[model samples]
Target: MRCGTRWARSNHFRSLPQRPDSMSIVLTPQELRSHLERFPRVSLGYYPTPLDHWTQLEKHLNRKGRFYAKREDLSGLAFGGNKVRQLEFLLGDALAVGADVIVHGAAVQSNYCRTLAAASRKLGLDCHLVLSRAYDQPEDQGNFLLDRIAGVSIELIDEPLGAEQEARKRRATERLAAAGRRPYLITYPQSEILGTASFVGAAVEIFDQFQGLPSVPRYVATAAVGATQAGLLLGLRLLGWKGHVLGFSPLNGGEYAIQEAIWSGIRAVAQLLDIEPSLEPNDVHNLADYAGDGYAKVSTAAVDAIKLLAQTEGVFLDPVYTGKAMAGLLDYFQKQKIPPEEDVIFVHTGGNTALFAYHREVLSLL
Candidate 1:
């Protein structure tokens, strides 16, 4: 019935040894009361999603590390994905500040955009999206299809004019204000980190889940982005998760660029939680070696990894984010960089629907 602890009742973990040392890291109701006040958020997900062993996948990895998955993808809103967790807090903040509408910018296939649309609908707020030409959807599939189905208003910004997109969204907000709509921009530098808080809450959930387990993970790998990775790292520090929070960037940016985003998100966490300013930039770990050809463009290994997982585990991972991250994880396992018997949890950030677009490439791999 509790957040992270709810998984304790699942049949998956029932057969495993009940190590007396195994413990859960969720916050007490009292602690949550204090922790939540520092951050503003919306209620958009079912927190403490199940943590289950990927025994099938783990065994295949053939590494010493134990493999586990924190199913944030099952967060229980808008067809489930990790973004729902962040939206719960991010949108909650927007509403608390009297925002009647929310706007964001991302690629057309952005899970964030789709999930935000769903969050806006649930909270009775209008939603607007600005995306680059590459994200433009002529037919609608994956997140794009879902966005249309959700009835989210759209503005397609051709080319790479980042400033123009921001200005347009801002102008849209102004127009809404003129129309007596208390629109919330949910723009970057503010809403970005607010969305990250949910992930920090997630980190706390992870800490609780691992507390009872006798063995500890040496590394926890997950896809990186502006928010998900940030929240995970912050939560690790907050709860003192004694493991390497490995962020495998799906995009092509290098360590410093990725670290900058993570640092900003970390600052947001510190400010929201009144946490000590003790975190250092060096504390963050980026797995840059795995980003093959850069963001969104499928790499050879990424294609292979997707096929391997589908055939072996029957778990479909999206080509853009989760699939690529899993590619890195599998690579590490094969290379023997991750030691055997060490506990490792991969955060499955959900985007399987996106795979259909790359059907030809994916089909070739199988």
Candidate 2:
């Protein structure tokens, strides 16, 4: 593979010095082949998603800095999302393991479920989703509508906040099994490891993408989940990228949930891929400041950020995740945590569909 300084000029490249210890965990071309030896991955996504700079948003924020976005939303499985990459590896594993049905639990607007449903259809597996409908709203918004249109079997549990919905998913899975169908739980606590591995795979691509940059990025930011952040951080460490990987949480949950998920994902990536690196609990940074009010609640700041991006950059941000993440990024700029010369990359995990559903809420901001 080619490597050089000019390669760093592109928005995607972040230059960094080579780590001697990187060899220990770094997968050689041969090692990558061997490491992914038994892993079956289908052509379910558009790999090497473009890493382009959000110049308009950067200028609108008036930051003395560079802001880039990795368009993971264009993953091309269903409507696109960061989950597609994970689903590529995950659904591949499900098929390899002979799972005839896929089941997961999340909120009604889960992009993962939408992608999972599409992937399951492609793989000829039945997809089931358990959704928590705590808010009194129709399910025809964003991903919820997509899930219905995808013909995914769904069970809506009307539980308030703090309710444990995992049990509902388990019950749904059991129902499928009782009906003589083979069912697999796709969003178990244990699946974080597998999910993280998918991001690790993504990080490998990023390493190649940035092979020729002069100055490496000081930080990389993405929406927090057990898998995406965990996998990227672990993969970056494996590839000798020493910059900070920040996982900004869109949810209003305590710090523990994100940390636990991150650590679990890191461990999973290390063990499954045979990569070694020190990942401490303290090293995990989950920014909850942008979650104004709570998860699913659209703060004024987030709404403003979303609208600003759309008007300035023609980019749509979901009210739940990316909007809040962008809010956090802007907050950092306002607080002067990020200097102008530093390179900052934001992972656009994608949920623009949600913006349409929340159009009224967003319009009110104007």
Candidate 3:
């Protein structure tokens, strides 16, 4: 949140204000692509998702600058979400090590679970999911249903998402290995770090898409858990762009934990790309206030955001991730944290399938 004298608010780039010398350096899209090619990748989703200029939403808000949503939501996969991007590199790592089975875990209606299952099937690999019972409803709808359709092995645990649940996933991976199956645990940090490369590639793609002024967003925001956000920041850094990367934490609390995750992601990703990390902890902003009551619990504001986008732009955002992020974007706009004069982008890290699971809550808001 400490982006000082941004070009967005200052005369619309007709005259730009002074920034640190680090901001002066810029890299070409091809340079970033070369660095990204060093890592192996699986083509599970479409590359360079569209940068949509939501003029209808902009008209509704009556903002002067350009308003865009980088549609990672429309990633061409089983259901399409940002997880498709991460899984490309993550699954590639699995194949590189000859992994025949992929083991992962998260909440019951996780976008990651659905995407991974679909990708695993695509690559002819077995998939197993150790899911936490984080929801109060039947798991017969939304992403869980999709998982069932994928025919992946499923273990629904009574625990919530935390270290204990992570341990459960590791144990499951070990059990798979004992059965003489080659397994890759995507829950591990090493595998998770590879996901960063996908988003870093995303930043490079978005940067190239933004070739003109006013169309270029000064603020790039997303629902992040550090690694994804860090990769985007690294992409911007390598390109010598100091655009504000606003991260809305889907998890409601734990400020320190969020900061640690993001900083570690920055460090880990830089190491992966063989560059000294140029991003500091302070540079990262994990805004968790918009996370309603807790993780997976949709807030009133988030529902409003979901409704607004759907009604105006015909874009549907899932209750858990992108909806809350859109809420934060509006909150920032209201508070002038992201002023009206500067362009802004909300990175739609998709999860609309969860809408069916949270139908009652979403309907109440309407």
Most accurate candidate by TM-score: 3
Per-residue lDDT tens digits of candidate 1, residues 1-366? 011111111232234333354233444534644665555566777877988787777667666567888887788888788888877766766665667777777777777888889889998988878876654343456777888899988888775536777777777777777788777675666555765677777777887788767686768889886678887877776665556778888766652377787888888656545555346788787766667776666677887777777787777787778888888888777677777667888998887767865666567766
lDDT of 3 by residue, 1-366 (tens): 111111111222223332233232356889778767766679998878998889999999988878888899888998798889998987876786678998888888888899999999999999989998866744989999999999999999988877888888778878888888888777546544677778889999888888854556778999987667878888888787877899998886762387777777677666545565456779888888998887888789999999999999999998889899899889888888877899988899988998998999899998
Ten residues in a row with the worst lDDT in model 1? 1-10
- Identify the runs in model 2 with alpha carbons over 4 angstroms from their true place: 1-38, 62-64, 160-164, 212-214, 253-256
TM-score of each: 0.86, 0.87, 0.90
Name the top lDDT candidate.
Answer: 3
Q: Kindly state the number of residue pairs that clash in model 2.
A: 5
Q: After superposition, how far is residue 65 of candidate 3 from its true place, in Å?
A: 1.3
Model 1: residues with Cα > 4 Å off, grouped in runs? 1-33, 135-138, 254-256
lDDT of each: 0.71, 0.73, 0.80
Candidate 3's C-alpha runs over 4 A off are 1-26, 212-215
**Model 2 lDDT, full chain set:** 0.73
Tell me the number of clashing residue pairs for each predicted model: 21, 5, 0
Give one digit per residue, the lDDT tens place, for model 2 in 63-126. Answer: 7667777888888877788888888776766665566888786778777787888888888888
Task: Please tell me which model should have the higher lDDT, number 1 or number 3.
Answer: 3
